[model samples]
Target: MNPMAAMKAYAAVQGGGMPTGGAAPAAAPGFGEMLQNVMGDMTKQTRAAETQMTGAIQGQSNMIDVVTSVSSAEASLETVIAVRDQVIQAYQEIMRMPI
Candidate 1:
């Protein structure tokens, strides 16, 4: 399966659920846990890109692969940051509204 699909599946499993032939309901991760997971994935992708860059520099891998990996990691990191920012902004807006 694609990585995102796999991640969702794993997240569902982690939340004490088994698939019942349909998509699971959203289960928001705690703030700390979400941050931790994002950081972990960022670190992993950064390391992988670094490894690819190192290989390319040493003539052990192709420059195209290194560049692609780096860009993909950068994009993924940006997406995570954007999502976190949006979530924070939403909370702030909710706090400001009269309830």
Candidate 2:
């Protein structure tokens, strides 16, 4: 998947919608909502990959399709992990801030 398209999809799933010329009126999604969205996306990608692999095993899908799906799922998983790490680091930094 194209990185820009992936980013746009992520933003949309986070309740921000795709960026427009004007600023979006919606408030940013809460941490829980963001986490849920990310998890949901990961689940979808994983399922798709699994389905594609199963089809390939049954000789109903192309090997290239299976490979693409698996790669997309892997990328999605990595993106989630990276985002999770960033969120944790931000929380730790915030906790260390003098109030």
Candidate 3:
């Protein structure tokens, strides 16, 4: 997945899920599911980029296309890392709160 698509999906998952002030729908996925989806997408993008790189090395894929794919994969990776860091920070903050 491209960075934009990944980011959009992230936003959709993060957006105020419960309609207005009502309870969230039972069909809504939990945080774990959202994180899993992001990780899966990231892995897919990385794999595609790797395949492009391999093709380029074999003189089959265009160098420009390979570069673009690799850059997109890198951006998506950075986005995922940033999200992971945010989640970890949030967890640490919650752990410090008095019960």
Candidate 4:
């Protein structure tokens, strides 16, 4: 079983749809902007992981630090992939609707 399988399942079940109630539009970030921010963070984590691994190789960082950073980056990557897959699935589902 994938480590993120539960998270992915929860995300899929949530549907991530827009709110139907009347709320301040400015209070919430737009979907596109939120996704962009997540992408940026993922990039940063990947870079950080690489740096940690390099430091470990040079004996500047411990194996524990390297392992933790790499694990974090891997989790982020999996999250991004799960989000991408969900978005694609949503798009496909929308396309199948008879309008």
Best by TM-score: 3
Tens-place lDDT per residue, model 1, 1-99, is: 226834864675587656567888566566577657766777777888999999988999998989988986887688677878998999999999997
Which 10-residue window of candidate 1 scores lowest in summed lDDT? 1-10
What lDDT score is found at residue 70 in candidate 2?
Answer: 95
Task: Tell me the deviation in Å of residue 66 in model 4.
Answer: 0.2
| lDDT (C-alpha) at residue 48 in model 4 | 92
Task: Give the Cα-based TM-score of candidate 3 against the true structure.
Answer: 0.77
TM for every model, in the order presented, reads: 0.64, 0.71, 0.77, 0.74
Model 2 per-residue lDDT tens digits across residues 1-94: 4375468556756765566678766777675875787678788889999999999999999999999989988998988888889989999999
All models, RMSD in angstroms:
5.4, 4.5, 3.4, 5.9
Instruction: List the global CA lDDT of all models.
Output: 0.75, 0.81, 0.81, 0.76
lDDT value, candidate 3, whole model: 0.81
lDDT of 4 by residue, 17-73 (tens): 675789633344557766776777778888998999999989999999899888988
What shift in Å separates residue 94 of candidate 1 from its native position after superposition? 2.4
Off by over 4 Å in 4: 1-26
Pick out the ten consecutive residues of candidate 2 with the lowest summed lDDT.
Answer: 1-10
